[model samples]
Target: MTTRTPAAAVAALTLGLLLSSCALLDGSTGGDPTDAPSAQASERQRPTPPFVRQGRMSIEGGNDVTFELTVTGLEHDGEYLMLEVTHNYLEDLPGSVTGRNPPVRLVDPVSGEVLRFLHDPQSGDEPYGTHFVPGDPAMPTHEGLPTTLRRYFPAPTQDVDYLTLTGAGIGLVPGIPLTRVDAFTPAPEPNAHEYIDPETFAQEPELPDEIWYPDNPPPPGLDTADRRQTMESFVDGPTASTTRAGDQETIALHADEMFAFDDSEPTADAAQTIRAGAQTLRSHIGPRVEEITIVGHTDGVGSDTHNQTLSQERAEAARALLERELDGEFTLTIEGRGSAEPLATEGGPDDEQARARNRRVEFTYQVSPGADGSADTDGLASARRHVAEPAHFFDELEPVTTLIHDDVDLHVYPMVRDGAYAFQMVGLQNSTLSPLEADLDVDASAVPGGPAQYTQGTLGGFRVQEPDTGLIRYVVRIRTGDGEYEDFADRINELATGEQYLALAVFPAPAPDVTEMTLYAGAFGQVDVPVR
Candidate 1:
């Protein structure tokens, strides 16, 4: 992942001037030094900047959502004017639009000039400017909190005295004076970075007869909808609707069919059953199956922990058996969900019949749409260590950001791999009466030219974060953000309140050098989270 180009790795900060010549991550050109002070002057006045703000204001989204956007002060960061904002969301239940980068415009108080946010119009709105926010769409409102955000606008000239804000839905905020220049937080210099080149395939590389993409090529909607429809089909019988070959196909198997009562090991006759399942996979997947995911489940018969492990073990056993039939030449993933997810939700815990029904494994196979005898069969490297939850991640969990309003604490424990720097994001003690949700992907902006993550758009979004020197690189391999691990998305989406679950979210990996990266956590300002 560190194979950055000479142009990508050039550190703009080392050049001394804030507006030094360098390629911005958003695929935009940079370096109009005329707006910035000389390097010597910028370094001299880097600290103890003056404060310049009058107060805050409120704006209603017409119905329901309201924002408490305050102009805390102003800072001159080279050519950009950093407007410090204290955004307090008022009068809403949990899951409001707190963690989002809504569009903002600036109206020059005197000249009546409207300054739209200066950014790559093609890029997703998040972590505005050079900051990366997982390149996801703006997250829906979460329980509103008191937090400060910095919006960088092209600095108003010395002639312009004040500027008012025009926000989407939130409407216009009061005016803020623009006096001092070049005394705000300077944008971090981008390090020599490494990433994929879109133009490399620019002539619109033929879309494979089918996209050999993730479960959700662009997002979860289609895949989830398919799953929902598949479940519906299951009610009618185990019939697959889309079996054009090389597309996605799913098969369901009851636990009783593969294992004896209370056992993880496959039964003797299970070999034939698994072989049949594998044949079904091979026939429907056609020439090459790019990926196979086996999800195991159990009824609410045992403790959650025990049930989860049992389910996992069963899934693993099933995988091993399938591999024997396939000669270990296919992509496979095994997951277990003890009683945490029962197929028979309405069934009581002690119901043996329902538990038996809940005990099962699901096999989902995806084949590269245009696969031939000579196609690339490499699938995403399956997690060597499967975790039932984020707590099992190989990193220490620590609170990274604490927001206002809701009793939610954002914690991140960094996980740096050889190719990327990923973090395990967690939201704790969401005391709302409903489940609280937080999408780090939706909340954070992806860095320009950042490594591709699972959450990236079809056009792709960069999620790399280079701090200080350009030596370390943080690349994101999109996390599911389904709250299976990070719980924030789960709780919030589920609207589960008054719960204290240590929900963890594991972001993709980053380069090893980035032991720590600075993130502007809500309300806390800039906080450095160490990638442990």
Candidate 2:
């Protein structure tokens, strides 16, 4: 039940973009439960379909598309019905097809109860074949090729044999056909099928349940950013607590919390405390925060020269620690106030407790009014300041594949990152005055056939196979733009006129022994892109 989608579909989904929804298919409720699709009575009680040569059924689909439904395997061992389905799409996509939900469901023709996949999509427990397992299909060879996926439903008794496939924006065809089926070998038992608990499978666990209350800040194996959970500094500290001042938040860290007597270096205990303070700071400041001002102070007991030096060093130390702990996207400014400002007290400079309290560090952060990087960005404004270079610089990139489609020219540059294939989609030009719309999607599945449904397939998609071994180099992410990671994993619906954008698609790095690979791009066809 891994939410299978067309390789092109994930861009909209993974990026959280809301597109138009397709209308749901309607089905009637009353029908005989025991009737079989075939006239033979003996075949009704059989565990699988009788072997029929060329056993494939084609349905004329909406949007000028033809759906070829063929069964590769089927079996019902009491508890659950296991079925394999492959749908081959023929003809071109209709103009009306935009970013829309193509949700599909398995329906009981007789009972009218909508059935779900055996495993939950959110469970992250996908069958091995789910992503192009030899027989399992999530791979596509061409737009017109059949891609397969497996499905599970309440087992149909001897009386029940036929099922229905329903989808949004598509009409339901009763008594859908299944292809070549024989008695299942080593039939599976009811207990063998995985059952989903609604409560447990409702959503993916953000953190492992076993380490919900880890003894340390970060549970082992968690990402670095998640490790911030380990920060205990902000939780319980008299010297440091989050206090809101006007519109800004302040992490008020008392001197005693960070440093020991007469020391500019962070104390052994203060190291952990500072780490906690840094994590707390991130929660308050956020990644969008641009500036962090760290100011340090000292008591009146030290000479003005010594206090100034100590305050400067302490402020610098605190700034370094915070920068390392935070997202490191801010401009940090460290300053030394020395003994200029002490805690207000009746004894003033003479009070011993006040003197100790005077030595402290304060952190403040600020953000620009236009930090969201929307369509209109000042960064873009600044980019306009530089002289525009000629377009030929891209041609200098060696071994590029240039192809023209719908009057637009596309340049593909294959590169490597961390030993993985990271190809660039560059030089996308409209080459027309009236304006044009083009799909710039990429493939995510490694299989030759698409997922059971057509959603996971990519029309103009590509994959890499080791030339010597023919092993697939699966894709992981697709980003658009030239700036190192400017559009990392971003899905821009369509490229319009005058829109000059580049994309970078990443795959698992091939081994050093892999010197060459066969790059397969759906319509663009296969090409040999060298491995570095």
Best by TM-score: 1
Q: What is the TM-score of candidate 2?
A: 0.25
- Looking at candidate 1, the ten consecutive residues that score lowest on lDDT are 227-236
lDDT (10s digit) by residue, model 1, range 230-289: 100011012111111113444557678778887998888788767766655554465544
Compute each candidate's TM-score over C-alphas: 0.26, 0.25
For model 2, what is the error of residue 440's alpha carbon versus the real structure, in angstroms, after optimal superposition?
73
Segments in model 1 whose C-alpha atoms lie over 4 Å from true places: 1-232, 235-247, 286-288, 346-350, 367-532
**lDDT top scorer:** 2
